[model samples]
Target chain A: MAATDKIFQHGTLGLLVPGLFDGTITAGELLTHGDTGIGTLDGLNGEVIIINGHAYQAREDGQVREIAADETLPFASVHFEKPDISAPIEATNQADFETQVVRDYRLRNVFAAIRIDGTFKTIKTRVAPRQQPPYKTLVQATATQPEFSGEHVQGTIVGYYAPQLFQGATVGGFHLHFLSQDHQLGGHLLGFEIEQAELKIQHFADFQVHLPIDNEAYLQEEFDNETIDHAINKAER
Target chain B: MAATDKIFQHGTLGLLVPGLFDGTITAGELLTHGDTGIGTLDGLNGEVIIINGHAYQAREDGQVREIAADETLPFASVHFEKPDISAPIEATNQADFETQVVRDYRLRNVFAAIRIDGTFKTIKTRVAPRQQPPYKTLVQATATQPEFSGEHVQGTIVGYYAPQLFQGATVGGFHLHFLSQDHQLGGHLLGFEIEQAELKIQHFADFQVHLPIDNEAYLQEEFDNETIDHAINKAER
Candidate 1:
C-alpha cells in the first residue's frame, strides 16, 4: 500500500526523513499545490496541488490541505503519546491496626490531598491537549515518614502531576511519599499492591478517574472496616 | 518575627519545607521523632510548633516565647504572602521588516503555529513545561534567507519578544516551528526552534486560566484577509 494508504489504514504514519531532526511524518502531513497532478505523472503515490499558480508536493491522504500563496498554514496539529500509570499498593499500617489506623488515615489523607492538588495544578498549568484519548493523569502517594515525630508512623508523601489532569487526560508516572511517625521503627509496613482496576469519570465528569488496585473503596469495604468489624462480631458470637 | 515565620510570610513555603529530592532534614531525623523539624526553619517568625507534639515557640516583637507542656494556648492562624506575577514583558523579534509583504506574513504565521503546536505536544508527552518563550514575536522581516534552511535569520529587530515566548506551563521546555513562503519567489520553506518556559500554580483556580501574555490571538488576527490585503497592497505600491 502507498504511504498515504498505510497511514490511513493504521490511523498513524511516520517517516524518518533525513536532515529533518529525525523527522517522522506521522498521520498528519502538510500538502500544497504541486502534490495534486504530479502523483500520476511521476508515479508519486501522494496528492498534488498548486500554490501561487505553481505546483508542489502534497500528501493525498493527509489531514492538512493546500493553501493559496497568500494564505498561511499553522503547524496544524501536534500531540504526544501518553505515559503509563500502574503500581502496587502498600498497606503499611496493616501490622499495627490500633496505632497505625489513626496515623495512617491522617497520613493517607494528607498525602492524597497533596498528590491530588499537585497533580491537578501541574496538568492545568503544564499540559495542553491536542486531540483526545490517552488522557493524562497524575498519581502521587507516600508510604514512609521521617522518625522525628517520635511515633512509629509512615513517612510523608508528596506528588505532582506534570500537566494537571483534565476531563479526559491519560495517566503517567508515580511519586511515592514515605514517612514514619516514630524514629526507630523500620521495614516497609505498607505492604499492598496496586492493580489497574478501571478507568472512569469523576467530579461530575470534570476529571478522568483512574482507580488504583488498592483504591480507597476496596480498602474500606474489604480490608479495613469490613475485616475488622467481621473479626470483632465473630469473636462476640 | 522568627525565621520560620519569615519564610512562610515571604511565600517561600516550598523552600522552607525541604523538597522530596533535596531536603535539609537528616535521614535519621526522618526516621526518628524529635523536637527539631526536618527542613529549614529559615525566615520563620511568630508562634510555631517544632518537633512532633512538642512545645510551641512564639516570637513576638522580636522576642521568643517557649510554651510549657501543660499550657493550653488559644487558636491562631498563619497566612503566607503571594508571589508577584507581572514582570516586564520581554520583547522579541525586533528586526526591520525588510522582507516582501507576503513572505513576512507567511513567516509570522508559521512561527506562531510551530510555537503553539510544539508546546502542546511537549506538555502532552513530557510532564515538564518549557521555561522560556518559544518564538520571538517581533521577527525582523529581512528579505534574505539563511544559507542553511534551519539556521536562524540574521539581522536585529527592535522591540521583539526576547528568549522566545513559552511563558506558560510550570515545567519542561518549548519548541518552535517556522514556515516561510516567498510569493515573489514561488516556493515554501520550514524550520524550527526549541526553548523553555515555566510557571508555578499554587491553587486550583490559578490553573483554570491561560497565561497572561500569550500572543496567539494577536498572531491569528494578523492572518486575517484585511491584514494580508493591506500588506500586499503596500508591497505592490
Candidate 2:
C-alpha cells in the first residue's frame, strides 16, 4: 500500500514474445500497484490503458471498454505517481518526439512514466487480436493484426520508458498505448504526430517485475537469450 | 512497507560492470525493502551479506564487520520472507548445486532467494579492493583483487538466482557471497564444496530494481550493450 513512485509490472516481454499469454493476475490485483500505466489484457486481448485508477482495454476493431475487475492480465506495467515535470511539447513525429523528450529532459538512462494529453495530427496504432489456447508468438499475432489511424484525434498516450539495459525484459524504449477521450478508439501506439499536447512525466528509479511463477509454463520453460532478443525486436520495435 | 516475498534490489550489475561504484542509497534506507540479502558497499569496498536483520561486510584481508547505518551501497538484492522450503542438501560443487537445486525444486525461470549454512570442504572467494575516484571497470578492478580460500570452513552463503533473462541487469545465473560463522572470513564466492549444508529457498515471481537515478554517473552514462555484456561475463563469471 505504499504510494511510492515505482513501477509494478506483471510478466515480461520475454515471456510474451514466446507466446505465453495466459493471464496470471487479475485487473483488481494490478490496480493495487499503480493508478496510471499501460499493458495488455488476458491472452493479449488488445492493449491495456490505465488512467486515473481505471483499467480499459482497446480491441483490434478500434473498440474501447472498461475491463472487469476479475479479468486477468498476462503483461502490464502500473505506477502511482504525480507528474514531477509537466510541459507543452512541440515534437510531432514518433522518433523526433522520443529523441527530443529523452534528451531535453535528461531521462536518458533512468526509468520514467509518461502521460501526454493532446490532439494528435495523425495517429496510427494496432491492437492484438484476442487469442485462445495455443497462442501464437507476438510476431505471428501482429503479422496479420488490424490497425487504426485517423487525421485528428484527441486522446491520452500512456506508457513506461525503460533504459537500454532492460532490452528484452521490457521495452528498451517507450512502450506506449493510446486511448481516446471518447473511449471509441485506440490501442498500442505504432505512429503519431501530435498537433498540441501537454506532456507529464514522472521519472522514477525503481521497477518491480511481478513474474508469473505459478504458471507451469513459466517455471518449466527455458528462455534462450538470442530467441528473446530477436523476437522482442521483431515484434515490439 | 509491504512485506511481500519479492527480491528488492538497488542499482544493477549493469551499472557495476561499468564502474559506477558511487553509492546512491544508504544502508539504512535499503533495509526498509528487505532484511536478508547481499550487496557491496560504497566505492565497491567489499562484499555485503545480510543475515537475521543485520548487515555485515567482508573485506579482502579476511575481515568481517557490522556495517554502520550511514554506510552506502552501490548494488544489492534483498527480501523479507520466511523460507518456503528448508532442508539438507548434498550437492557440493557450484555447478552441480545450481543445476540440481533448480531442477529438483522446480526453481527454473523464476526468481528465488537461496541461503545455505554448512561446513565447507573447501571454499574460495575474493573481495573488491576498496576503491576511490577514477574507478576502474569491474573486470579491471577484479583482475588484481585479493582472494581468500580455505578448507574445513564453517559459514553461510547468501545470494539470488536470476533467470537467464536478467543477463547483465543482474547475474543471469547464481550470484552468491559467503561469510564464515566466526565472522573471520568470507567474500564474493568464487567456488566452494560443501561437506554438509542445509538449504533454504523462497521462490518468488517478483523482482524490484531500484535504479540509482540521482547518480550523475548513472543518468548521464550511455550503457553500451556489448560493453556491459562482455564486462559482466568476463568479471562476474
Candidate 3:
C-alpha cells in the first residue's frame, strides 16, 4: 500500500510543555525506530538531531557533540523511509519555506519527514536553556533563549511536519533543526535564506505516537491541553 | 514495557469529518490488527463493533448482523492485548461512566481499549444515515440521525479512549459502540443506565493512525481543524 510509510514518535509535546522533562528513552533505543529524527534531551537539556544513524546534541551554550547512547530523550519523532518525492524548493526564510511546502507540496493535513541539504545565503537558529529540576513550563524556560546566525553558511535542516491538529502532540508545522556541514553551529532552525538546496520529503501515512505511560508525572498529573497549546505556540512560534 | 500495548487505527476522525467516507481497508484486514475493535463501515453505512474476532454492523435501519470479511472500514481502533486493569464500575449514565473512568482509572491522558459487559437498566444508541456520493460532513450527516432505546438490555460496550489532544486523530474521550447479546439492538452509544457492568481497560501507550493517503478527497482537500472540532463535539455529544 502507498500508505505504508510510517513515522514513530516518542512522548508528546504536551508532556514536555508542563515541565515533564525527565525521560528514559535512550538515544540508542530511539535509533532503533528511525535513522533520522529531531528532539530534545532529558531535562530539556539541548536540541537533538539524528542523521544517518548518528545522534548529536546541540547545547544551548553553542557546542555540538555526539550524544551518548544512553542519553535520554523526552520527545522525538523518527522514521526510516526513502523519500517518495525529491525536488528543489523556493523560499526565502523558514516561514516562507513552510508556507510554500504547505501550498506547493500540499502537506498541510498530513505528516511529512522533511530534509533540506545545501548551501544558504544566511541561516539562523535558536536553542532553549538547559533546564534543571523544579523545571518551569516550556514558555517560561524559553523566555530568554539565545539565537545564533551566520551569513553564507552551508548546513542541513532536519525535522518533521505535523498537521495543526497535532499541536499538543507535537509542534505543528515544520519543526526543523539545523546543523552546519562543519558540525560547529546548529540548533532549532529559526530562519534561513537558501542559496541552493534539495528537498527530500517522505509522506508518512502512518503516524505512531508512543506516550510515557509509565511515568508517574505523565499518568497522574492533570495536563492542561488548552494551556499547553498556548505554551507551545509561544515557545516554538 | 507496560508501554508496549498499541492501538492500531485506520484513518482519522479528521478525515471522516471532511466527508471522505469511501474506504479500502477490509474488515478482515482490520481484525488482523486487533481481536476487539470499533469503527464504521465504508460509506458510513453503520457502526461496527468487533469482539472475540467477530465483526458486526449495527445498521441505521435497526438491523444488526455479522459484518462480511470484505466489508471496508473508514475508521477503527483495535488492539491485541489483555486488560491491564479490570474492575466494577459505578455510574448512572454514559457521561457519569466517562467521568468516573477518567477520574478513577486515570485514563485522561492515555489511550485505552475499554470494554463494559453486563446488563443495563436502560440504554440509548444512535446511527448516522447512510451516505453515497457527494457526502456531507459528519456533523451534517448525523444531524437528524436516528436513536434507539431499550429497557433491561443485556449487551456489551466496546471502543477506545482517546485523550483530548487526539481530538482530530480520533474522537476525544470514550467513543463507544454497543451490541446487544441477542443481536436485537446496537450502534454508537448515546446514553445508558447500568444495572451492573464490568470495566476492562488496556493501557495503550502506542497509538498508530493510518491515513488514506491514496484517497483523492483526502489528499487535495483543505481541512479546517477548528470547524471539525466543533462539529465533532456537536455530533458526538
Top candidate on DockQ is: 2
Deviation (Å) of B141 in candidate 1: 30
Q: Give each prediction's DockQ, rounded to 2 decimals.
A: 0.01, 0.83, 0.70
- B125-216, model 1: which lDDT tens digit per residue? 00111112222111112122222232322210000110111111110011211111110110111222322222111110101111111122
Cα lDDT of model 2 by residue, B1-237, tens digit: 658578889999999887899988888998888889999999989899998778999987779999998999999889996789899998889889999998888877888899999999999998988888799888888788889998999999998888888887898888899989998888989999989999999888789898888788888888887688888888777
Fraction of true contacts reproduced, model 2? 0.91
Chain A TM-score across all models, in listed order: 0.15, 0.97, 0.96
lDDT of 3 by residue, B1-237 (tens): 322379999988877887888875899988888889888888988888899889999999998999889989888878785898889888878888888888887898899999999999999999877899799888888888888889999999999899888887789888999999999999999889999989899988899988877776777767777877888888766
- Residue B205 Cα positional deviation in candidate 1, in Å, after optimal superposition: 27
Candidate 2, residues A1-237, lDDT tens digits: the string is: 656678888988888887888999999999988899888888888899999999999998788899989999988899996889999988989899899989988887878998999999998888889888798877887777788988789999999889988987888888898998888778888999989999999998788898998889878777777788888787776
Q: Which of the predicted structures, 1 or 3, would earn the higher DockQ when compared with the native?
A: 3
For all predicted structures, in order, the TM-scores are 0.16, 0.97, 0.95
How many pairs in model 3 have backbone atoms within 3 A of each other, for residues 3 or more apart or on separate chains, i.e. clashes? 0
Error in Å for residue B89 of model 2: 0.6
| Model 1 chain B lowest lDDT segment of ten | B156-165
| Docking level of model 2 | high
| Candidate 1 residue spans exceeding 4 A from truth | A1-155, A161-171, A185-237, B1-175, B179-237
For candidate 1, lDDT tens digit of each residue in A10-106? 0000000000011122222323211111111011122222222232223322222333333222111111111122222233222332234224332
Q: Candidate 3: where is the Cα deviation over 4 Å?
A: A1-4, B1-4
How big is the positional error of residue B100 in model 2, measured in Å on the Cα after superposition?
0.4
What local lDDT score does residue A165 receive in model 2, on the 0 to 100 scale? 88
How many clashes (backbone N, Cα, C below 3 Å) per candidate? 117, 0, 0
